[model samples]
Target: MTTLRIGIIGVGGIAQTRHIPAFLELRDQCTIMALSDVNIERARETAEKYRIPHVFENYHDLFSKVDAVCICTPNKFHAEISIAALEAGVHVLCEKPMALNVAEGEAMLSASIKADKVLAIGYHYRFMKEAQAAKKAMQDIGTPLVTRVQALRRRKVPGWGVFTNKDLQGGGSLIDYGCHLLDLALWLTGNQKPISITGSTYNRLSKTPNQINIWGEYDHDTFDVDDHVTAYIKFENGASMLFETSWAANIKDDQEHVSISGTNGGLSVFPFELYTAKNGMLLNSEAAWLPGNEDFGLSQAQNFVDACLGNAELIVQPHEALQVSQIIEAIYENDKS
Candidate 1:
């Protein structure tokens, strides 16, 4: 395998925690050549810690040195960075919400195709073993009856970062948390086209602006984003999805779940259980899942590396990612109108 030199942009928490570590795991196939962030000190620190050979105070500098980049910046910068990197002939594995809106995402897509480069999104849950197990169980259902998903967290607003700022991150819990389950559902259902979306967002919890927070405290008065969201989508294939997510909510379950109903079988994940009728009897089974899929960042990095070598196909293509952005934008519009 030719060593595919790599670079990382926006070396924030996600970059240090996931992307760098994933690249480290694929040392034989890739090298972490450069790191960049507007915060030069932090970028230098991350480069030192990760042992990447070079550090850039700006992303454009990193683009000149690496074959690909992992975009871990805020939603607003995603398109600009990905398009810039692609035009520079570098491949990209961008974080989800591919871009802030459909049009920007389309531009990102156009750049990727125009440059003839690999552009993949970090929809890591698709590779989760439980998710894979759920997809496999769908064979008997013939067609999906319903997709029930909840990606909830109780009073855990990430108030410390740009997450609470609507301008930088775009929207709140729906775009941040709910987008995961939404993408997972669409992927499992074979990404059948979507007909329309209806959704709503509420700022009920942190609206007071000076409110105390579980993750960190921020000016409550300036807390300008949703803390909770719910979306109802109808797929063209007749599969309907009901999604609920929150950074703060009055709910009991604080984790994630995707319960699917099919004609011959039903499956519930995040607990990895499968149910079906066989031999005139009902059967229940659960797969023993480990934390293997916990390395989605690494898996994505490896995928980009493999695609560079023509050894594998991209798991999340740019066009499919653009569709995800379209639905996301539609849901946001549905919430307001």
Candidate 2:
């Protein structure tokens, strides 16, 4: 087996907590050869801590040093960096949302096709054991008629990172946290093509003074992104999706759920339950066991590594990721209209 050399761009919290550790766990198959960040000091510190061999202030400088690169930068840089790395003959595993807009996502996809290197998005929720089981159960559900997804958090706005900055991260909970469940729902439904979308967004909670935030606190005056978003999407196949996501809500507790009603039956992801009718009686089944949270990240990393080495196919292709961006863009655009 040929070991792949990997480089990490943007040595921030996600890199330190998830991506780096995941790559390290697969040390026998791959190695973290280089690290880069806009903050040279941070990069150097991370390199020393991880015992990475090379550290560069610019990601381009570190690209040639590794066969694959993990782009964990903010949303604004996802497209530019991924395109550059792909052009440099390096496979890319980009952090989610793909890009700020559909155009950027299409451009990134184009570059990947032109470069002929693997481009995978970090929609790691698909790797969860329950998610895996739900996907299989979906096969038994028949054609989907409706998808209802909600990812709600109660006063848990992130206080760290550029999450609140609209220009930096694109949107708030929908793009950052909610996108995971959204992508999973769409993927499990086989990426049904959406014909139209109607949506609305709100930043009222984050912009209010004296707000209570569980994650920490950010400047209320500078909070310019959406803390909540709701949308109705109609797919070409006569299926429809009702989606709602929020970082701040008056709900009793946080909730994450994806339930799809199909022609034959229905399945919900949060509790990993399936519902159907058997012999004129209602039936509900739940998964007995699931892969741990840690394993999802590990499986995502392993899939990326395997794809880069030509040993397997990419599970999250660039075009599929681009569709996610397109839907998001439509939601935001529809809000303006």
Candidate 3:
């Protein structure tokens, strides 16, 4: 039982809430050796709170002290830090959206290959019980024809952190919340090759003052990113997908859904249901008891550790994660056109 030494970069909300806790849960296999953040005070406080051994304001300094690093930085910095860590012979577990664009993702991938170290993306949604069950059930539904995805939140724009900053976070709802479902849908569908994408994004809600934001309140004057986005994607296999996501909408409640229609059956993720016609009657079946209480973040953490130790294959490879970024880039590019 070799305990892998791990460092954490960017001690932000995601690091504090998910990455730190998840790594702590795998104490038998890994230890939080150090932590780094642009905010030295925050890094020192987080290290003290979590009992981390070391703290550094520069991520580069922390890399030399740890065998692996978990990057929870803003999208713009993900590529630079990940590439450096990988080049330094350390495994990397980068938080989602992989990078701001496909080019940066490719660089990270290249560095991982050159370093011969594991590079895993933090698309923890794939570890969910419902998502796992849905993937297995896809065997019953042969040849998916279409995918429909929606991740909508009503008046829940995250008012904290750099989420509203386009420079730091890249985009808003689509890249922040929607990327999880997008990655999940692509993974569940076997990482289909996207042929084309058409998209439109809006920031009308974020620009409107006096809006009820459950997360908190942000500066409407500086809210320049998209709060809503819709897109249509066509895959190389002739399969098509329709996607819609938002941080705020005029809806009664938040909705998260992913459903695929195949030749034999159709399935939806949220409620975990299967629909098909048996004989002559239409039938809808729901999973009786799909385990839902397990900590996916912990599971993801363990997977990264195992992969780094050569005990298991990475469930979310960098190349697969790159496809998600490519589609996202395509969507934004299309919107610009």
Candidate 4:
């Protein structure tokens, strides 16, 4: 078994909390070979903490030391770093939203194709135990008619990182927090082509003075991204979706829900429920026990490593992730139009 050598770009919170630890846990399959960040000191400190061998301030310099790279950088850098890695003949596992928009995503996809290397997006929700179960249960639902996705957090706007920076992360709740469930819903529904999208975005709550927020505090005057977003989409296959996501809603609690109604039956993802009309009766089934790794980040890392070594297929393909970017871009564009 050839162990894959993996490098991590951007030694930030996501890298330390998710990517680095997950890859470290799979030592038998892959090794964390190198680390890089704009903050070279932080990268060196993270490398020392993880006992990783090589460290570089430039991601390009670090690419030569590893067979694959996990990009945990901001949305602005995802495309540039990914294209560079792919062109360098190294596999890439980029953090979600694929890119800031569809154009950059297409370039990343093209580079991967030209390089003949793997390009996987970090739609880690797909690796969740319940999400895995829901993928298989999708077969029972038949052709989907309508899908509903709600990724809401009540007054929990992130006060750390560049999450509020429109230029760095592209958008707020929709791109950062909501993209996970959106990607999962699209993947479960077979990546149907979106025909039309109608969306509305709001940041009035986030921009208000002295707002009550659960996640620290931020400058209300500089809050430029959307805190709440709602969209309705129509797919080419006659299916439609009602999507709503927020970072600062007046809702009761944080909710992450995805439910699909289909021609045959219906299913919900968060709790892994199945709704079917069986034997002339309406029934809802919930799994008392589910299989697969409970830690989705670990599962995602393992899958990326396996795919890099040609041992398994990527659950989040680049194009499917691009479709997600397409939908997100349309939503934002609709707001402007």
Candidate 5:
């Protein structure tokens, strides 16, 4: 068994909280060999805490020391770091909204293909136990007709890090939070190519003078990103989607829902339920229990390591991630029109 040497770029909260822990848990298969960040002090501290061998201020300098790299940088750097890693002959597992837009995503994809390396997007929602069950159950629902997605949060705009920075993170809510559910919906529907999209984005709440918020506080006047977004998409395969997401909305509570109405039956993710007409009677079925590891982050890390070792296929392929980026870009563009 060849244990992969894994490097982590950007020693930020995501790296500390999710990627590092997940990769560490899979220590038998992969080792966190090196880490890098523009903040060299944080990188050194994280390296010391994790007992990782090497730390570098430059990501390019750390690449040669590892077989793969997990990019946890802001949206603005995803494509740049990913391309550099891939071109260095290292597999890449980049944090999601693969890039700021489709063009960058395509370039990242090209780099991966050119280097013949694995390019896995960090859409870890698909690795959840319920999501895995839903993928298998999708066959029972027949061809998908419509998908409804709502990733709503009640006054919980992240008040930490570069989340509110439009230049570093691009759009908010839709790009930061909504992209996860959107990726899952598209994946379950066989990655249907979206043909048309119309969308609206709102930042009025964040831009208000004073607001009630659960996730700390931000400078209202300086807020320049969408806090809410809604869209309608038509796929080439005749499947349509109604998508709504928000970081701060007047909703009852935070909601993360994805449901698909198919030609034969229907299914909903989140709680994992199935609906159908069986034997001339209406039927609804829910899982009494489900299988698979519940920790999506660990499962996602394992999958990436296995793919790097050629023992498994990537769950979130580069092109599928690019499709998600396409829709996100379209939605932001539609907001302008």
Candidate 6:
């Protein structure tokens, strides 16, 4: 196996929790070369922990040494670092949500196209076996008419770090937590054209001065982002989707399911169940299957390297991920009304 030299930017929570560990898992096929973070101390700490040789306080300084880079920054820096990496002729595997807006996504995609390098967004859940099985099972539904996504956590607002700040992290739970399900919904639907979106957001709980927060206690009065979001989307192909996501939603069950309904049958993931309106019985049968526990981050990193080496196809192309950004931007735009 050829070794792909990899570097990591942003030694934040995500980089520590997911990217570093995931890249470590691919030691046989890849070399961990560099680590970069705005906080030089944190960057050096991460490099020390991961045993990576090179460390840089600035991301631009690492471009010449690595074959590819994993961008693990906030929503705003995704496009900037990605474009920079691509322009310097390095492949990039950027974390989700891809960017703060569609135009930024376009610029990143354009750079990837112009540079002729691989640019795969970190929509890793799509690489899960359960999700891949759901895509295959989608045919059983036969042309989905309605799709629904719910990634709601009852009163479990992430009240730590930048979670409560809208400026650092464009939107709240919907953009952070719900984006996973949103991307899953679109990927399963084969990236259909969305015509319009109607959305609404609320901050009933966060408005209070003090409140119960799971991640940690914080100033609820200063929480300026939306804690709840609901959206209805219309597709050009006549399909309709309803998305509901929140960090502190007043609902039973911390729900995380993306369901697709069709004339012949229906499918519900998370529980990994499929119901078909067939066989003389009114009740639908269960889908017999095992859950997909694949290391999506590892798979994602491997795919980027594979695509760069011309050994495999791009899992989630730039244009496909761009559509997701478009839908997300539309929802945020309409929800402002």
Please say which candidate is ahead in TM-score: 1 or 4.
4
| CA lDDT for candidate 5 | 0.94
The Cα local distance difference test for each model comes to 0.84, 0.92, 0.92, 0.94, 0.94, 0.85
For candidate 5, which ten residues in a row score worst on lDDT? 287-296
Q: Give Cα distance to truth, residue 145, candidate 5, Å.
A: 0.7
Worst 10 residues of 2 by lDDT: 286-295
Q: Across residues 113-139, which tens digit of lDDT does each residue of candidate 4 receive?
A: 999999999999999888888999999
Question: Which parts of model 4 have CA positions greater than 4 angstroms off?
Answer: 290-292
Question: TM-score for model 3?
Answer: 0.97
Cα error of candidate 3 at position 24, Å: 1.2
In model 4, how large is the Cα lDDT of residue 333? 97
Summarize candidate 2's per-residue lDDT along 210-298 as a digit string, tens digits: 99899998999999999999999999999999999999988899999899999999999988999999898999998778345548888
In model 3, which runs have C-alpha deviations exceeding 4 angstroms? 290-293
- Per-candidate TM vs. native? 0.95, 0.98, 0.97, 0.98, 0.98, 0.95
For candidate 3, write residues 167-188 as lDDT tens digits.
9888999999999999999998
**For model 5, which pairs clash?**
none
Which is superior by lDDT, 2 or 6?
Answer: 2
Per-residue lDDT of candidate 6, residues 169-245 (tens digit):
78887778888899999989888988889998888876776666666776766888888899999999999999999
The alpha-carbon deviation from the true structure for residue 99 of candidate 1, after best TM-score superposition, in angstroms, is 0.6
**Whole-structure CA lDDT of model 6:** 0.85
Query: 1-337, model 5: which lDDT tens digit per residue?
Result: 4999999999888899899999999988989999999999989999999999999998999998999999999999999999998988999999998999889999999999999999999999999888888999999999999999999998988999889999999899999999999999999999988899999999998899789989998999889889999999999998999999999998888999999999899999999999999898999999878454688899999999999999999999999999999999999998898
- How close to the true structure is residue 62 of candidate 6, measured as C-alpha lDDT? 100
Count of backbone collisions within predicted model 3: 0
